[model samples]
Target: MLFVTIDRKSSVSLTQQIYDQIRKSILNRDLEEGERLASSRGLSAAIGVSRNVVLEAYERLIAEGYLEVRSKSGTFVAKGSFLPAKGKTSEYEKVMPNVADRKPIIDFRGSHPAMDQFPRKKWGQLTRDICYEAPDHIFGYAEPGGIRELRVTLAKYLQRVRSVHCHPEQIMITTGATQALRLITEMLIKARTGISVEDPVTDEMRNIFFSAGAGIIPVPVDENGIIPECLPKEEGTGFVFVIPSHQFPMGGILSIQRRVQLIQYARELNNYIVEDDYDSEFTYEGAPVPSIQGLDPERVIYVGTFSKILSPALRMGFVVLPTHLIETFRRLKWFHDRHTSSIDQLVLSRFIEEGYLDRHIRKMRRIYRKRREVLETAVRASFKNAKIIGRAAGMHLVVDIPDIDFDDALAGEIEKQGVRIYPVEHFAMNKGRHTHQVVMGYGSLTPEQILQGVTQLKKFLSTRG
Candidate 1:
C-alpha cells in the first residue's frame, strides 16, 4: 500500500503538494523509473482528497513526462525518467529590480512614466461605461487574438498615429511586452532562428531570448540607433530586435537613412525586424518618427504597450504580426494563457474609440516635455563635459562622465545623498562601453524634484575632486 499525506491546513493546493512530493521522490531516486504508482481512485481513498483532485495531479505529472498511462493498466512512472541532480551548494537567488533602499528624496532610476498625469477620472468613467456597454462575452474566454473591438480600434489608432499599416487580424493583444516577446521568441526558436539585439539592453529582455534557447547576437548602436552595417551577416539570423523609434536608456532615434538601411538589410537577410516602439509618445524636440515597420510591413513585428503611455500597473500591450506569422502566432497565443483580461481590453477599446487616448497623450506630452527640459538644463549647469546622449526623444537621457570611474561605488555615494540613479553599465551585456554613463529619468519627477536631484548629484560629483 502507498502511504501519502495531505496537509489540509497548508495554503498550497493538495494537487500541487502531491505533485511536488512525487516529483521529489523521483529526483531523490526513492521511486524507481518505471515503478507503478497507485491509481487516482486508490490514492484519493488513501489521502482522503477528491478523486478528481488526484486525477488532476496525475494528469499534470503525466503531461510533464513524470508518469505514463497504459491501456487497462495502473499508472506508472515513465521509463528512463531523470530530474537534474541537485547541486551541493544552494543556487543564488535573483535580486529584485528595485531593491527598496530607504525611499530616496529624488529618484532618477529609469523606466518610469508620468503617473501623476494619468487621467484617472476619465479612465474610471471609461471602465464603468464600457463594462456597462460591453456584451456578456467580455467576461467569458476572450477571442484567442483578443476581443475583436479592441483589435479593430487599435488598428485604426496605430495607423493614424504611428504610420503602421496592419489589418485587425494581424494584431494581437498580450498581457504585456514580456508576453509578446515570449511568444515571438518561441516562434523564432521554432524556426531555428538567431536574434540580433541592441548590445546595451536590459537583462530582463536578454533573459527572455536566453530562456527560449535562441542565439543572441549583440549588435552595436551609435547615436543613429542600431547600426545596420553591424547586423549579423551570418545565415540563420532570423531577426533584429530594435527600439528604433526611441532607443531606451541611451535614447537615440534611428536616423531615416539607417531605417532604410535596416529595411534593406532585413530584405537581403530574409529576416524580420521587431520594432519596440516603447516611448515614442514623449519626444520633445521634433515630431515623432514614423515606425520603421511602415517602411517594410512584411518583415517587421511591431509591439506597443500602454504601460508607458498609461499607468505601468496596467499590463496592457499589443503585438502587430506580419501576415506570414499570424496563424502560428495566434495558435501559440491561444495556448499561452487563453487571453488577456477581457474587461480591460474592452475598456481600453472604448477608451481609444472615444478619443480619450489621444487627449491623454497630448496632455502628458506637454507635461513630460517640460520635465525633460528641466532635467537637461540642470545637467548643462552642473557639468561642462556632460555629453548628453539621446535627448532628442524619450523620457530619460544618458549623461556620459569622463575621467572618472562611475561604477557601483559612485552610485552608492549618490544613494547616500538621498538620490537614486541607474548606471548605464547596469543594462550592458558585454559591458565596458557604457560604464562612464548614468541614465536619468525625468518623466516621473516634478520640475522642482528634478532640479533638486541634479543639485545633489552635482554636489556629490564636486566632492569627488
Candidate 2:
C-alpha cells in the first residue's frame, strides 16, 4: 500500500488529510505517475478510516488533476503531463508561504477610508430622495458630459474650496483620479513626448505612464515637496504630474512661492501641469492651501476625486480643464467612457447641494485631526527616534526608519509579527531614496488600534538590534 496516515482526533477532516498526503506523495516522486491508488474499501479497512472518507479523498484528488476516475473502475494517478519538466520553472504557480493568510495584529496599510465613519443612513436617504424626485430625463442615458446640476455644483464647490477657476461646462466627470490620469496619459503621453514625474512618486502613475510608452524624467523632491528648480528645462517635455497640496508618502505641502514657480515654469515651457489634488480636504492646521490650478487655470489640469473625501468604491472624480482644451478633453472623454453614471452624478449633486458633503467633511476633519494627534503622541512615546513626514494633511504619514533600509526582509519580519506597513521603496522610480521610510495610514484606524500598532512597531524595531 502507498504510504499514508489519518488522524481522527485532529481538526483536519479525513478527506483533507488524505488529499494532502497523496498530493505530497506525488509531488515528492514517491508515488510515480500512473501509480494506482488502492480501492476505497480496502484503503478504508487498512487505514481504519471510513469508506466514505477514502472515496471523498479520491474524488478531490481526481478534481485536482492528481488522480483520474474511470467509470466503475479503480482510481489511478494521472501521467506526469501537468508537472514541470526537469530544470524548468513556472512563474504562474510559484509557491511562496502564504503571508497574507496570517491575520495582522496592527494594520496601517494606506488609502482605505473608514466605512464605519461614513453617514450611511444620511446617504441612503439622500439617494432615495434623488430617485423620488427624478424627472423623466433621469431615467435615460445622461448627457455624455455628466449631469448638468452636478457639474455646476462641483464647479462652485471646487472654486470656493480650492480656488480653481472654471465654469461648469469645463468640468468632466470620471470614474476616479486614476482613470482621469489614465485617460489623460493616453490622450497626451504619446507622440514621443517625455513626462516629468517626481521621483519617489505614486507607483501606479509610474506604471501608467510607462505603459503609455512615455519617457519619464524623475524630478527630485525635498521636505518642501518637489523642487521646481531640479526640473529639466527641455522642450520635449509635455506633462508634469504633481501632488501639490499634500505630497503622497511624504507629507510636505508646496508653498505658495513654489506653487507660483511651478505654474510659471509650466507656462514658460508651454507644458501642461496635471495637478492631482488628492486628499487635500483633511488639513489639521491653519486655512486650506489654494490649489496650483488657481494660479493659472489655463495651464493646469486639476484632478479631484471623491474617493478620499467620501469612499473609494464610489469611483467618482472630476477634472477641471482649461477652456481651450475643453473641446479636446470632451472629444477624448466621448470616445473614452463618455460620462460617469447618471444616477451617481445626480445623487452626489444632491448631496453637495443639500450641504451633506460639507457637513460630513467638517466632522471628519475634526475627527481625523485628533486621530493624527493621538498617532503622533503614540509614535513619540514609542519610537522616539523616528521622524514623521506629511502629518499636516492626508490619510497617511511616512515614518522615517533612519539609517536602516526597510527592505523586503524587514517588511516580512514585521508582517510575521502581526503588523503591516508599506515600504516607501515600493513607490520610488529610483530605489534607495525612500529606503528608510514606511507609510502608515491612520484614516481607518482607531486611536486604540493606532496606539497598539505603533507600539508593536516600536517593539519590533527595537528588537532588530
Candidate 3:
C-alpha cells in the first residue's frame, strides 16, 4: 500500500500522478494481486491529499482493470492483476549505439536501390514535358487499373524480356509490391487460406499476409528455391507467393523443372500463384530466367515493380492478373485509392519509351556485379568462418556468420564500429534454418564503402573473441 504525494502547483493533476505511482508500484510487484487497497479517506489523509483526489485515482485504476471494487467489500487489486513491464525495450536497447561513437558507416538494408546512378536530368525533363502537354482529362480520375499507356508499356516490356503474358487491360498499377499484395489479399482472401511462403523470405510480406488473417504456412527453399513438395496437402490454399527470380535476401533461382512442378501444384489445388519478379531486371547470369507466369497464365499473377531499377520514391509497381481475376482486381483498385498517380505514370511511360530505363539497368548491373565481388572478397579476407550465399544475382547476398549468435547484441557491436548488417532471424516467422546468417545489401554501397564497412565488421567481431 505505497502512496505518493502530489503537489497541486504541478502541471499534472493530483489524481493522474497518484494513478501513475500506484500503477508503477503494481507493475514493480510492490503491490501484488488480490491485495486490498487502503480506503480513500485513509489514503488521502496519509498522502496529504483530498478524498476526492484519492477517489478519482482509484476509479481510474479500476477502469483500467488493475483494481476491482465490490458494493461493500471495498477496493482490492484485481484477480490476475500482476503487470509486466513492456519487454521490447531490452531488444531495441541492445541495438542502440551513440551515432557519434562511430564514424560514417555504409548501410546494407535490403530492397534499397542505387539512387546515385538514377538519371535525374532526363527524368526532370520528361516530367516537365508531361506537365506541359497534359490534358485536363489526365488530371481527373482515370481508370483505377492504371494509365493505359503505362499498362501497355508494362505489358510489352514484360512479354518481350521476361516472358510474362498479359494484355494492358489486365495490368493493375500499384504504389509498390507491398500495396499490390495488400489489394490482392483484401479482394481475393476472405477467411484463412493456407498461404504458402518461402522460408527465409522477406519479413515485410509475412507481416502483410499475417495481418490480413491468412494462416501462413512456411515452405522450405533448397538450392533451387521454394520446394514445391513442402506445401501442405491442404484443400483451401488460396495462393503461393514466390520470388522465384533471385529469391529475396537469398539468391536462389528456381530451376525450370521446379518451376513447372510449382505451376502444376498450384493448378491441382485450384490456387493462384503470385510471381514477384522483384529485382529480376539486374540478373547478371545466363540469359535472365523466364517468368513462371509464361508457363500457366491462367494460374499465375505476375507482379513487377520499377522500385529496384529506378527508385522506390517513384512508388510504381504493377500486377498482371489472369483473365478470370482482372475484373476483381480492377474493382479492388477502384475502392482502394481510385488509382496510382497519373503524373508519375505518364513520366515513367516516357522514361521506358525513350530507352533510359533499359540503359540505366544495364549500367547498374555491371556496377553491382563489381560491388558484390568486392564484398565477397573482403568477407573471405576478414572472416574465416563466414559463408556467402546468393551472389549470382540481385543487389544483396546472405552471409552465414558462423560461431556467432548474430542476435541484437552482436548487431549493435558491429553497428557501434560503423558497419550495418541485417539479422536474417528477424525475417523468420516459423523460425527457418538460417539463424546465424545476416542479409547484406550492396546496391547503394560503393566499392570503397563495402571494403571499409567489411573491415570494421571484422574488427567488431575480433572484439567478441
Best by lDDT: 3
Question: Each model's TM-score, in the order given?
Answer: 0.77, 0.78, 0.77
lDDT digits (tens) for residues 115-227 of candidate 3: 99888999999999999998989999988889999989888888889998888888999988888988877765775466888887888898888887787888878668988
Per-residue C-alpha lDDT of model 1 across residues 94-187, encoded as one tens digit per residue:
3443456456568886768888888889889988887788788677887778888899999999999899999999999998998899899998
- Per lDDT, what order, best first? 3, 1, 2
lDDT of each: 0.85, 0.83, 0.85
RMSD of each: 9.3, 7.4, 10.1
Cα lDDT tens digits, model 2, 1-465, are 387787778999888998888888887777887777899999999999889988898888888788886778778788872445467555654665467775856778676677678778887888888788889788887666678999999999998888999899989898888878877777776664799988778788888888777889988887888899988887788689898888887878888888888888988988899999878888888877898888888899999999988898789988888888777777777787867888889889989988999999898888787777888888777766778887478778888857668977888888887888888888887787788898888889898898888878878888878
Candidate 1, position 238, lDDT:
69
C-alpha positional error of residue 389 in candidate 1 after TM-score superposition, expressed in Å? 1.2
